[model samples]
Target: MTRDDPRHDVAAVVAALVAEASDGQITAAGALAEPDSLALLGLTSLGQVRLIQAVERRFGIAVEPDDDLVALDTVESLARYLRERGVA
Candidate 1:
């Protein structure tokens, strides 16, 4: 889909994943500080795998197991990453 497509709002997906990772206790402000202040929310390596799986399932997209999703550290980054991979 095109970048401007409403379906390409990767931030929403990422936010959902972050909320899931945090067990729904993380608010928008909290998730934004993930990997730093929100490190206690279980955003670990295993959590990353779970997030990827969730993203794939939610979006009906197949992401390579080794795909570089680590760079998706922020909502904006995740959106750009999805766009670059043609998933958004």
Candidate 2:
């Protein structure tokens, strides 16, 4: 799939994770303001694992340990991350 493919709904993925982790305090758009570090989101080890699983299932792709998602910090970052990983 191309970069603009509908299947690569990075905003939705980020929103889902933010909602799941923060109980709705952050949103897809709001996630853009998060620090450029994955740790700022309080994504614990378990949370990261869950997020990775969700992303994999949603995108129908396998996420390697060194995948771009590990460096993702913002919604845009996540979108580009998936794109770079050839998810769509």
Candidate 3:
């Protein structure tokens, strides 16, 4: 597989994961536009679980239960966090 800068590409992964988890209820633009408002993105309780799993799998990093959910609210923010962890 080809690789790119995680800083630039992480948003795509996050967007895809959110779309998959949300079942198309949210779009990448909408999610990126409002990176801090997850509720507005239609992320339900079940969707949250799916998103977390997707993140873990994509980044190969396990998210601890103590991790703040609020921090993963946006594609950009999530990408930044993952990139910081050397996921790129």
Q: Find the candidate with the highest TM-score and give its number.
A: 3
Best model per lDDT: 3
Where model 1 places Cα greater than 4 Å from the true spot, the runs are 1-8, 33-42
Candidate 2 regions off by >4 Å? Answer: 1-9, 21-29
* Pairs of colliding residues, candidate 2: 1-88
Question: Against the correct fold, how does model 1 do in TM-score?
Answer: 0.62
Give per-residue CA lDDT, model 3, range 9-80, as digits (tens): 778778878888888898766766774766677888888899999889878898787866566777777777
Position 31, candidate 2: lDDT: 66
Q: How accurate is candidate 1 locally (lDDT)?
A: 0.63
Candidate 2: C-alpha RMSD to true structure equals: 4.1
Kindly list the per-residue Cα lDDT of model 2 for residues 1-88, writing each as its tens digit: 5667743466656657655655554554566566575457565666667666777787787778765454555556776777787754
lDDT of 1 by residue, 1-88 (tens): 7777754467766776767865676665566555433345546666666666777787677777587755546655665677776764
lDDT of 1 at 32: 56
Arranged by TM-score, best first: 3, 2, 1
The candidate 2 region of ten consecutive residues with least summed lDDT is: 21-30
Model 1: how far residue 34 lies from native, Å: 4.9
Each model's TM-score? 0.62, 0.62, 0.81
